[model samples]
Target: MYQLIALDLKAARKEKTTKQKESLAKIALLHQNVQSLGNSINEINQMLMDHDDCKFICITEHWKSQDQIINYGIRNFKLASCFCRKEGKHGGSAVFVSLAVQCLERSDIRSLSVVGSFECAAVKCSLNGMNFIILSIYRTPSGNMHVFLEKMEQILSKISDDSASVFIAGDFNIDFSQDSPNKQLSCSLLNSYNIQQTIFQFTRITSASESCIDNIFTNISPFVSNVINSSISDHTAQKITVMVDMNKPANAVKKRILNNERFLCRLKSVDWQNVFHIPQNDVNEQWNYFSNIFQSIFEQVFPMKTFKVTNRFTDSHHPEKIKNNIKECKDRLDVLYVISNSDNSYKPCYNKEKSTINY
Candidate 1:
């Protein structure tokens, strides 16, 4: 019986190891039409916390201005790129890339536009030594579909080389479920460059209607893809999974910092006057003697160590107080939402709280 129990324990350990390996094998990405990130930014944060495996989040219809982006920043992930609507207040797109992923905005493609009717934000990054171009696009329903397609074609033409894989995920506003001319044209345009739409299920579900407007188009198929049912927003969040080795070494510089309090305490305990009374003829020798004593005290009190430089975005500078304030505002909003129910009373309160948090 003891031998059997030991075997069972061994099997459990092996199963646990296998589970850990499987969890580390893939990186999850979420794409969603937030409609207006300003109102539901807290929900996004909660979603991220719940889905810890998600590394990247691509959002469309953010309905946010350039200034508002600062307030909607997430903790670990950095806002790599954003294309806000120039004239109107709505219809914007943004990509938040994880710090673990080395990504930079593709300014070349970003600058190219078709009268600014459509929005697109691209980032070039390497994951596990494999290079990829990730784009988040949002096409306004009012925009000319032909012009949008032509602009997309132009952008695709520029990055059509077989060097890097491309992943485009967004709310195109073109219903792929129905046999529409726009859908056909979009599919044909994508197919011309060997890009395939991976999402087939209805991303936007409503009581009256359902459609697969939100999509994930990629040149390379993702290892895992699914539509997450969420009450965070009206539309469901689409998730794509890819394997990435996050163990890549980072280029970092080390610098020393002194713990002033500890150093002062150590200095207070020393007989400074005695140490300064060194038998030296030259002023330089006396200065050197003083410096050596200071250095010894500093080293003993405040040792130095190296850490990676990971502050690549403005959000990195946000203080803990600001995070706490944001959380408090979210909690208040939740309470107000529950109390108001179907009433419009929560709108004003939410807006007021949002302004306070941003401030």
Candidate 2:
């Protein structure tokens, strides 16, 4: 599923003309429901590698605790802000911004409203000279829609007075496909603040139907807005592109990659028996001796070499044959689903094929 999305992004980039590429500085915003980011970290990394311009990624349903937040960090990006459910282990929200972008959590706004049955994380940042307040939220399936909207009204009311552009994207759990009262009220409330939803297509896909529950709303007009067809999760990823000034100077940083094989070999070669041998008279002397030996080994084994970072997207290491196999699995599942609808004998076959896809 992730490989398919990466391939599509690569193909899209290749199809772009030189003129279109050089027109303006564009930042892409991506939102997804990574059932558990810890389990889908590789897929998220592949998506980021494929779309380097993605400056902000809003993730819902992270299913992580406060102490486990560090485990979901993405390379080259900073975890700007996150909100985890206090009572349960299921619902959570997070926003990751590129290291090049200046971003900070908006605790003042977050403090103004209490998240009763929903999770939300917001960040204020400047990207390519444009200031924005981006929010990532996840509303539970059984959460009260009216209560959530009331809190949203307060947040938007406060932010509407500011000049910085506002973007609120998330899985609100309101099915836009049906003419439900909650959907109508949500749309009307957004309209009152002159905020337009950028995502028009359905985000969640299934064998039987689809829905537009995931959305991106912003006050400023974006350069482009579309949904990326992916099976990384039940919901497809929504991407929004906005143009910014390209004349701003860039801040580039260098990072080091340690040689783990050499480090491990050096550690294994250490004579632990001799290192542990110490004078029984003074405990401080024994501690100092061990510390010195450890420091010396670390310095010799793990020397750092700096490499300057660039705006180049790396290709995925996943093989083409494996991607073809995944595609074939999806095709087989679709065929089985269609057949099962008409013939009762195909129901078991559909279930077997579905289990193989691991969607």
| Candidate models: Cα lDDT each | 0.68, 0.69
Judged by lDDT against the true structure, how good is candidate 1?
A: 0.68
Q: Tell how far residue 348 is off in model 1, in angstroms.
A: 59
TM-score of 1: 0.60
lDDT of 1 by residue, 1-359 (tens): 99999999999999988876764456667898988888888888888887888767889888888788867887688999888866756788888988888988877666654423568878887666556678888887777775676567656655643245678888888999875656765775576456788888998888899999888887655467889886767889998876643343333323233344454456446554553466645545554554456556645654444556453222122345434433443333333232223225446545654565453
Q: Which 10-residue window of candidate 1 scores lowest in summed lDDT?
A: 334-343
In candidate 1, position 97 carries an lDDT of 88
RMSD of each: 25.0, 25.5
Off by over 4 Å in 2: 1-23, 112-116, 245-359
In TM-score terms, which candidate is top? 2
| Candidate 2, 1-359: lDDT as tens digits | 99999999988887775546675687789999888888888888887787898989999888888789877778889999888766767788889999999987877555533343457888888765666788998887788764576567656655543445678889888887765656755775575456778888899988998899999988666558988865678998898888764553333322223344454455446564553366566645554554455446545643334333343211222345435433443433243233314335446555655675565
Write down the TM-score of every candidate: 0.60, 0.61
